[model samples]
Target: MDPIQRITTPTLDVLDALLTVDGPAWGLLVIKATGRQAGTVYPILERLERQGWITSSWDDETDRPGPRRRLYEFTPDGVDAARDLVAARPSAATPAPSAATPARPARSARPVTS
Candidate 1:
């Protein structure tokens, strides 16, 4: 992610969760940790992926119970950058979005045309 990008509260919570963990994190885990809905958590995850800050893969361990999970973790450079961003603004890390905050519009599968 660009250093100058505006880090939203949800994004900061996600980063904090990832940083505190020992290994790669999954979507549900992050969602619980941040106390944010899937809508808020997922878009931030996608944006982070597009910015090359994080990587994800399917958990293929057969020994594990339950369905496969998509796991995520920061890239080598992203580790430092994430820490810097969090440390730079500790007060910005709010875990929940207020009820007054407007929800983002859902994206449609079809492409828009003029």
Candidate 2:
């Protein structure tokens, strides 16, 4: 399946949140940003990691499986991709349709002539 097609709005939201956060975040923050369940968010995170879009490592300083966190952060490619995503964001601030680029005249709308 197409990767973009598989990416839901939540997936994009989660990705954006990760980029926004300077440090690694726990699963909870991801769930909050995407408004998705832990189950759903984790899988997407794993997929992104496996795809080399992001990387994750357990905090050495944190107590593993205790209060420790499994933090994640974007790779260089991920940053580039995020920038691309941001640029692609549609903005309402954009001016209305310009008359310069008029809609194409429909073939069916051609006038009947003798």
Which one is best on lDDT? Answer: 1
Return the TM-score for candidate 1, rounded to 2 decimals: 0.73
At residue 64, candidate 2 shows an lDDT of 45
Cα error, residue 52 of model 1, in Å, equals 0.5
Give the Å error, residue 92, model 2. 12
RMSD over all Cα atoms, model 1? 12.1
Candidate 1: segments with Cα more than 4 A from true spot: 91-114
TM-score of 2: 0.65
TM-score of each: 0.73, 0.65
Each prediction's RMSD to truth: 12.1, 9.9
Give lDDT tens digits, candidate 2, residues 32-114. Answer: 87689888889888887877777888778844456767788888887687666655555522557888898877776678799
